[model samples]
Target: MVRGKTQMRRIENATSRQVTFSKRRNGLLKKAFELSVLCDAELALIIFSSRGKLYEFSSSSMQATVGRYLRHTRSDQSHHLDQPLPHQHDLQAVQNEAASLLKEIESVEVSKRKLLGESLGTSSYEELQQLEQQLERSLSHIRARKHEVYREQIEQLKEKYDVEEERQQSPTQIQLAEVSPNYGESSSISDVETDLFIGPPKSRSK
Candidate 1:
């Protein structure tokens, strides 16, 4: 039978747990030693057991190796030393920003009035021409959009008329309108019936 893979979890039995820990720890240390010697690499391995016992191996002095690692890791951080770290804007910076925004608002308000034909005294001939062109372009776009809306309304009305015409049609109602064909025609007094007076003032009393 094929052997099942060893389950990678905490060993429940105390004796088995201790045995596994000792065997794995020794194997790990041996592997680290072989890796350092065969490849001639600087290596560090630090392990702490459940009982607080320390196991450490370093190719060089542990402190020196750790210090060298720190130096390499922090090399990029050296450039940041002279640069100011990010923080909230101070009072002076906020004031300056507010002043800049106020000036921008004033400029925008002036431009808005100029577009409405209010402020023309300060505008040059070129500025006036530019404004005129801008207004004409805006008007063209507005008119195009208006025409599109008009077409949509016409289509809706056409569809509505078609529906109403269909509703008025029936199997018996051949080529007839919903309203009377001779609805507004007037008949002479002699052709009309006496009881069905068309426009006699006496009908109002009834």
Candidate 2:
């Protein structure tokens, strides 16, 4: 029967580890070469020993392949180490990038929580006061504009009412002036009729 999965841990024995690395390294390189030859693919492989040894293979020029790898990984060539482990500078850079990404993720999470109304209680009194002030200012501006518009409308209505009143009074004054002369004439004619009815007042008294 095939061996089951082994526990995932670092091998303590140096010799056994070294043997495993060697076997694996050779197998990996052979597979890479075979793939390159069979599929006409460009290939490069890099491996290192635990004792700080450098090993590499490529289907093309090693420099060219390494340059290609550097371009793909966006890693600086100056920081590459000839040893088995990553350089200290590279490790630090990676750590810094990870920390920056973590900070960005945390900021996004906080924004999401705020949007969901989950962090309203966590806001400081100053923040709440500022928000209220902003809201009050906005309302004040809206009310002021509304009042100005209302005042303008009222002034227009008053002007229209004044014009209408002038028109109505002007027609009444014209009618009164036209009737006054006729009224006086009618009164004088009635006085003359009464004198005639008295027979010319007894022929003017001798």
Candidate 3:
């Protein structure tokens, strides 16, 4: 027959309660003895009844077992206390680095504001002079670059003019060569005609 599971509550009758306590206490002690014997374990159990009656079991000396349990718990707590948390140092380092970077960024922002003429009231005369000198140097560099650009442009224009002049005079030179019978035979006529028609070559001035 399948017996229904019993619902546990306090036994209201004092006599029944005492009887149940005696039976369960004996049963628990028997189980503890069996477990120690079967598993060859060091074990201890202790109980006190409502009337202050003591019930106890121990595979070895109860004092020794209790002492060992206390020592084990204390050592575990001490070990945890001694060791640092894994992230503590890393978190501190990251915080320090962040603070340093923040300071650098603020300094750069202040300098940028000064350069933009936004913080002029706070600047000293020496600082103003330094800024003025820096600006003058920058202006000088810009003017030098502008002059270099203009010189390059003029040189390019001069090259283009020389090329066009050569192109235009090429056909005329060819026609003159064909018309003059002694153009290639003798140098006298060619030299005289060159000087008379084109004039002596102009010397370049430094």
TM-score of each: 0.43, 0.35, 0.42
Clash numbers, per candidate = 0, 0, 0
As for candidate 1, its clashing pairs are: none
Top candidate by lDDT: 3
Order of candidate numbers by lDDT, starting with the best: 3, 1, 2
Better of 1 and 3 by lDDT: 3
Q: Which of the two candidates, 1 or 2, achieves a greater lDDT against the reference?
A: 1
List ranges where model 1 is wrong by over 4 Å. 1-31, 46-54, 60-123, 174-206
List model 1 lDDT by residue over 127-188, tens digit each.
99999999999999999999999999999999999999988878566634644565555333
Per residue, candidate 3 scores C-alpha lDDT tens digits across 44-78 of 99999998988899999999999999999999889
**If candidate 1 were superposed on the true structure by all CA atoms, what would the RMSD be?**
16.9
Cα-based RMSD of candidate 2: 21.9
Q: Candidate 3 — worst ten consecutive residues by lDDT sum?
A: 197-206
Q: Which candidate gets the maximum TM-score versus the true structure?
A: 1
lDDT of each: 0.87, 0.81, 0.89
